[model samples]
Target: MNKDSAQTALLWIVAAGFFMQSLDTTIVNTALPSIANSLHVAPLAMQPIIIAYTLTMAMLTPASGWLADRFGTRRVYFVAILIFVLGSICCASAHTLGQLVIARVLQGVGGSMLLPIGRLAVLRSVSGEQYVSALAFISVAGQLGPIAGPTLGGWFVQDMTWHWIFLINVPIGAVGLYAVRRFLPTHGETQAPPFDFVGCGLLSLCMIAFSLSIEAPFSTHRAAWAAGLFVLAVVSALAYIPYARRRRNPLFKLALFSEPNFSVGLIGNLVCRIGSSAVPFLVPLLLQLQLGYSPLHSGLMMLPAALAGTVAKRWIAPLIRRYGYDTFLLVNTLIVGSSIVAFALITRGTPLAIEIAILAVFGAANSMQFAAMNSVTLKDLSHEDAGSGNSLFSMVQMLAIGLGVSIGGGLVNLFSAQWGSAALGFRFSFACVGVITLVSAWIFRQLDVAPAQPKVRAPATHSAGR
Candidate 1:
């Protein structure tokens, strides 16, 4: 093929990888109830399936760039697609929750690499002048994934079976593999620096421990296990400070946190997301199990939120320009938090229009929240620190998603057991997560209040981080 044709084909390959990765993130959510029924487990008990995948992705994401540099992008990208497909097969064949969770971890290993490596490939293959447009083109796939994932997953579960939700990846991945081999440029391996294995391990241990602590309520020795894990998480996090200081090329330097906005934005992102991230997982289950909606209906119900979020993106730059990041994030964070709390008001008797309005408002506000948070976090980093800072931010984003599921799921279980009503449990859970989100507004308040300047768009990495 000609050079132009090859580049176009490469874009298609990368976009497909992104679509597959983003789709998997939300697709299984709609199918969770069905999968739970088939596997003879409670629907809410399936958080581990989601948590395992996201947490594994969080643990492995920092290594993706290094891997792509060490191994050729073409080779690693091809293998990523292969592993994802195989993991999907395993998910489809699983007979138990443990099996499904294990399969998801395998899937996460592949997914962790897809966007980072695919972006790396694009950087190498596409000309710099066209890079922004290239990323914009690929970002459509990322946006479409969340928009399509829930609806598609719901349709599969309702019309066919939950297995199809996973099995569907096989054909797409097959095409991706072929395209990767044929179109993706073979920029052979570069001489990468030695990876900070110790730093990576410490961070990974911290994330794992913290996530498990949230999940410990489900274990036999709940209190003891929770205490121990929380301690371990703290210790691991503390240990990383000294390790990174001593190492020549650590995973992430402490200097990145010296920037006021970066520190504030990073903390706000984690805390706010812990509450907001649970909505996607919790909303579908509430529709299906409590409200008696069909899986497809639940999935379709997510359309207002996703579409509203899309439409709201155009409003972000203008709003932020007028209010600045501090004012915008501060006010928007409350709106987002209140919108989440509003979910508590949803009931079997509530009007459908009101529910749709609530979802739309939350969707719009949440979308703006993500963009502002990301921009403010990385906006002040030096050129030398941008790469590491972005990677660390990406890791936190994934880690928050995992923790959100764990906390959301655990709250439901806790409240349900105490209240003796599943409906009340859902209501209370929503309230608690809303409060968690509300607290993050305080973090955003820490940003320096200055007049808005010309719009500074966040890097294309924001697209993949979503």
Candidate 2:
């Protein structure tokens, strides 16, 4: 019993790391406008602050597992916390937009390592019987971050200063650093094969090009620059395929996608997330700029969606079990997409209650879609593929978020130019992205009637993207 209790306490340490990483991802969104004003940059140009963090994470995530195996988990985890805390300090002290973006990149370097390595620690230490419960416990911390991040960010911006958003991590990270040294076990390094630096470079380049292209549409050389970047991005991504195929031990083996569902599921996830991820970034701006909502009020408005998403978790398993992954995902995708479209209709005169209801529906459906999609994508992977598959999925998830923000922001700017109104720009952008989401439903339709559910019991296990 004491041993079990000790393990449980250790899980809390892991959860704290997850919480800090997840919180930083979201906590800055509501504060973006305030941060821009403080830095003397336009609000729209601030997407790079958000993109830089997720993009850096995507670039570095593939190596996280290897780092833990090559070095001891405890040492690497301690350094990760140290770097993250120091990065937070840099972010608070940054005087210009370029300095802030650089700080975020540093923070992402640490954030990229935190959850995956912490998860590896838990998986190595805990028994199979205890794994699900331990993971579920840690995931609750991740979930709570989304719930608390916006509210905390808004309050800090309103009551104090935008810098407090980053400064708040100092104390939490300090305690986490100490806990890592005290409670974390000194595990032996694995005799894993040599790391694949070449493949990693190719994939990293691909992600950078693709992410940059999406943001190019908003630049001064909009058409020509976007075309050049788009072509380069395609070439780089395609280059990785042949390079991976020729390598002895690639970063992610091509065979992992032999299962039809995994391939389609991944493609669908990337496409669908490109639309859904933008809503969080765009919604706050819309509320503040068009609807005349305050930062605090906009943050509070997010509560209905986040709370409804939490409440909607229970509905997922039963629905999937009864209807199967294919039916559930197909139907749920439409609901999620349409709800996004419905947001385009919210004008200054729209009832607050009605707007909340629309957001709640989108939240519930999107949450359910993610859980189902994640399960189907990985449910078929063998134990050997589990680690790499999870890492690849995570990389794609972050990359999609960066792409989503870029695309949404670019589209808004484009439409704003055409319509001569930022409000109309937001409305048009929502509709276009919503349609993009709806098209992804066809990918889910390709799944077999009875799809495999993931063995991992926590509903949130597959929700790494969230």
Candidate 3:
């Protein structure tokens, strides 16, 4: 009984890591305006701050598993926490936008490693019977991070300075460091592969070039620079395809794409996310920039969504089970997409109560879409494929998020220039995002009527070394 209790405590600690990771993603959104004002940058130009962190994480995520396997998981996990805490401190102290962006990159390096390593730890340490429960706990906390982040960020920004948003991680990260160093285990016997530096470099270049090109066209008024970046992205992507094929062990293991479901799921996720992913970024910007809401009030507005999300989780699994993966994805995708449209249509005169209700509904549907889509993507992969598949999926998710900010932000700017109104531009951009999401539902049509449900696999024998 004591052993079981100890095991539960360790899992909870890992969940905390997951919580911090997701919290970091949303917490900064509400604070973006304040941070921009303090840093002397325009509010719209701040998308890069958000993009840089997620883009860095996406670029680095493909290697996280291999690193954990090569070095001991516990060691990598500890280093991740250390970097994360240090990075958080740097962000809090940063005096300029450039400094904060660089600090965020540092933080992303750690953030990229946190959940993947923690999830691997849970998979190794928890018994098979407990796998579902363990995952369920982590998912709940991680999801709550985004749900509560805006609210918490708004509260902090209103009550204190935006720097405190990053500072809050210092204490939490310190505790996590202690817990991880003490309780996380080592995988001592595994054969570690050589680091795939060439592939990693090529891949990172490709992602950076692609994401930057998307932003450059909208951010700066330099058409030549934007064109040059676009050309670079195209060249970099082509360069990686052949490089991945020729190598003995490529960074992505391109062979994995042969699986129909995995390929479709990944592309679907990337394309779909372009529309939905930027909502968090846009929501706070809308509330603060156009809606005339205070940071604290905007943050408070997010509470209902987060609270509703908690309640909505109970229904996701059942709906997916009853309707199957394809149906759930198709239907839920529409719900989420339509909600973004609804948000876009919101105007200054929209009743506060109505706006809050709208945000809450979008939050609930979106939370469901995440669970269902994530599970579906992994449902068919074999045990050997699970780790790589999941890692790749995570990389894609982050990359799309970065792209979403750039694409959504760029599009909004474009529409603003054409419409000659920032508010109208935001409206057009939201509608565009909605249309993009609506189109992605067709990807789900590829799935069979009785789509296979991804079952939670049992973890093998598992430990806390310290």
Ranking by TM-score: 1, 2, 3
Off by over 4 Å in 2: 449-465
Model 2, C-alpha of 196: deviation from truth (Å):
0.6
lDDT of 3: 0.79
- Candidate 1 ranges with C-alpha deviation above 4 Å: 218-221, 454-465
User: Estimated TM-score per prediction?
Assistant: 0.98, 0.96, 0.92
Q: Over the stretch 358-398, how does candidate 2's per-residue lDDT look in tens digits?
A: 98998889878777777888777788987678778878888
Q: Which residue pairs collide in model 1, if any?
A: none
Off by over 4 Å in 3: 448-466
Name the best candidate (by lDDT).
1
User: Which pairs of residues collide in model 3?
Assistant: none
In angstroms, what RMSD does candidate 1 have relative to the true structure?
1.4
The window of 10 residues in a row where model 3 has the poorest summed lDDT is 457-466
RMSD of each: 1.4, 1.9, 3.8
- lDDT by residue for model 3 (391-436), tens: 6777778788888888788888899889899999899889888878
